[model samples]
Target: MDNRTNLDDYLAELGISEADESVTPPPMPDASDSAPVQEAADTDARGTLERFLRGLIARIDPELSVTVREVDDALEAEISGENAARLAGRDGRTLGAIEVIAYTVLSKQEGRGDTRVRVDIGGFRKRQADTLSKLAERLAIGVAKSGEPHELQPMPAAERRVIHIALKEHPDVMSESVGEGASRRLVIKPRHG
Candidate 1:
């Protein structure tokens, strides 16, 4: 018999799954069908991403023993392992803020383009996404069970999008993004209205 496990367990562990397999994958993309599109997007996204990142570092912790590095197919800038936690902020809030700012700035600088880019400062956003995904799922379940709406703290539109997408699968709950501009937040509520 093939090894089998619950789908939720699979998603929790691997962040994704195959239709017929029990194997768990790491929390990165599969890079199969959309490789070319992804590759092209990243190629187009990198130059602006790097310029934004370098400028951010120069302004923030200029003497923190850290530096920004660029790659061809990267939509986000990475720093050497030497400096992660400090730049990452508490659970990546600071990093997320930086990324949002860069995305907004670069997208505007390039003439109001909705460029699809992800900014990862030292992998902080990566880890935070995984962690927040699970947290959002659980919190959604709780909100559904209690039939009470939950208002999350303010976060960027991107992060609110992250949580909104993560909890989309559960039919018992729904999410709405409210507030305006930088102070926006996601509110979870029972689906029945």
Candidate 2:
């Protein structure tokens, strides 16, 4: 009886294959250099973020890779490999949770002000933003043409911000958020003539 768990088989069951390049190649770490790597990570925000994301990824698949980079005022972490989508969850709830936790911990350690943290799995955030922007544009157009208010499905605060930003400069429509908590929605209204 073979008891060894095959990661490839498990990944395949999860709809991932060995041929997928989302998984990053592990670095060839020297036996003597591992401790220094850990030490160095504690000294920098970038390294700290990488370590945090790697820790989260390890919980799902020990072999999956996480990369963190400083992007503008935020620390962007990318999780690659088979289990990325699972970590991202439906509508990116899981990913958002992870980012919030990481950001909270990081802020506590370094003191909070600016520099937000974002997590992305397979460009999910970027794709979501693009989708939201396009939807906002279409809804704004509808509101402008019909002079009727267009209400979008309830979404998270971050998503609402995307819609607001997208329609902020529209000449014929204005975007606003209504409702509370999870039920909060984006509404586009025809600008008063």
Candidate 3:
């Protein structure tokens, strides 16, 4: 919520009478407000998530019903079949974009710089993660057995990070991030060298 909106709600919750309202409401903070200004902000993740979903659904596709939540250390978003395909995007890239936007908006609304909101669109991300993890495992094994470092194709940072972390604890194999931006990937090799 914006500062003005927040300040307004605070005044309302205090039950300011019409006679007392003339005394002037609290001045809303300006853009120059510092980090401590977050103290007055609303951190209600569920309520905010609900409002965001309603507004997003209204703008995106009114026919589609979207259920959104910030739960289990991730943002879980589900949309009805009416717009699932449209939201799913090409192999879920669009879904990834939606997650990014939701995380950002939620973070801003929550006044937190570090947020772990996970957005799932029609469970596409979950299923995709499983598939990518398997693929990474298979590639890692093949590269390790070949005695040659292998560079997998480019993938989103989230997917690549998953692969990197999964291979991090392996005694016989290791992973490194390479390339730039979305083009980045993982290079897996035998841990000995």
Candidate 4:
């Protein structure tokens, strides 16, 4: 007598017969395919992210377009369209969300590591950075003139980073972050003589 465990026999042992609809067997692996499918999937993270962002933009508005490129270890995506500002939202929260979603999806792919994706719409991020830099310089100058420390409204880590960088080489003022979590902000103080 032959002793073999077939699909029906195994399912029968587990009290699930061949007629059970919920106990279907999984699809068999493709024997002819020898490539590293998992690695292949992650090898084109930038391209995948570009496609994903474009699809997302399509859902928001079909007229929107996104251009993505690899900048060192990060992906920079620039979006242009009539509804681009809608993606930017107030203080770029919407754009940030899109980046987070893209990164999440990319990182979840097999073999991904330390993903960085930046999303910008119509150069809004550049304009915001420039405005923040100018504000940081103005605050630093004011602090130096009055010999008093000035505190800026709480901002996201990225904005605070811009402030610190903008004032890092200032002649008469220094910048630092204070507080915790969402309450964290930038403080400009007169440099000690």
Candidate 5:
């Protein structure tokens, strides 16, 4: 009926039980204790998220496992095991959905909304980044030699970012995103002096 109930139902379907909501409030602390309190909150949030992800993945496939770690001020959850590839889905749509849901749930918590979450299944994101990086390199070379711009197929913003980062410091080429929304694409162009 209510949003909380709906969220609980959704999480239940995903195999994550509703967390106990009966937490006792902590006493006010002095300024000197603020840093430790914040650090403890961060650790608690990370542990909660890790447990949630592990439960969700286990529901999908009992054999799957998730490892969560902090990377660049964000939480990265890597799912592995026999069903990892299948869970990633075609073009990683499933993985993307999982990441979105995970973040949404995490943000709903009182103090965890600012935490950033990244979910990668079976190294899918890593492999895709490597491929995109290599493609950017090859295209930059061609564009430099031909003095023409090469446009890439439409892709999600994240993928486009990969291409941009790949060519960020290229001596003879530059990358840009053109178009809008779902039709947006990356273009590699020669950088003339």
Candidate 6:
């Protein structure tokens, strides 16, 4: 049998059937609902994220600890412990993968379809953002002086956003994303008079 079939059979043996996944979810609250309702939803989303991360971290490494909190409109989760570095992998590819998975899982749950998730292991994401911002600033200065467009190394949409935001208010240069998918990158160009 295929891997998917194997997984299904495994779950069946564990008493988790496809029927268990079909429970109907409650209707979403109206936008006109009171502030307390929205606050409750936010709290529920945070609790769900925290529980999900705790289970995932236990599977990866029981020594790792996960803490989730609401940051603006997103759920920010920090994984730290003796083995937290293992989850970061090379250039944080593994951490990125986990974040994507977490987002997908949370988005599929009732009342959480719009919830955003950000997973960071050992503050890697914050450091990366800071580095990208600095790099964008330096590149913008160069483009302003040379009066030529400079293409940045291909990066994910999030990193490209960091670059774009960093230069959005610059007087002499602007940034734009080019290409598509994995090959997409940012270009810094001088503003014309």
Tens digits of per-residue lDDT for model 6 on 1-193?
A: 1112122333356585542333222333355656686797787667656666765665557788888888888899999997787679999999988898677556654347677788999788889999999998888888888899999889889899988999999999998999998999999999877
Decreasing lDDT order of the candidates: 5, 6, 4, 2, 3, 1
Candidate 3 overall lDDT versus native? 0.64
**Candidate 6 TM-score, true structure as reference:** 0.75
Worst 10 residues of 2 by lDDT: 1-10
TM-score of each predicted structure versus truth:
0.55, 0.68, 0.65, 0.73, 0.78, 0.75
Cα lDDT over the full model 1? 0.61
Q: Which candidate gets the maximum lDDT versus the true structure?
A: 5
lDDT of 4 by residue, 74-179 (tens): 7788999886887798878888887786786566542355867888997889999999998987788789899999988888888999889999889899989999
Task: Give the per-residue Cα lDDT of candidate 6 at 96.
Answer: 87
C-alpha positional error of residue 69 in candidate 2 after TM-score superposition, expressed in Å = 2.0
The regions of model 3 sitting more than 4 angstroms off are 1-43, 58-74, 80-85, 169-171
The local distance difference test score of model 2 is 0.71
Stretches off by above 4 angstroms in model 1 are: 1-45, 51-74, 90-113
Instruction: Assess each prediction's global lDDT (C-alpha) against the native.
Output: 0.61, 0.71, 0.64, 0.73, 0.78, 0.75
Q: Comparing 5 and 6 by TM-score, which wins?
A: 5
The digit string of per-residue lDDT tens for model 3 on 41-138 reads 33355445545654555545668676765555555667665556767789877776666666665666665446565666666777877887787788
Taking all chains together, the TM-score of candidate 2 against the true structure is 0.68
Query: How many clashing residue pairs, candidate 5?
Result: 0
Could you say which candidate leads in TM-score?
Answer: 5
Cα TM-score of candidate 4: 0.73
Q: Cα lDDT for residue 15, model 4? A: 88
Off by over 4 Å in 5: 1-8, 12-35
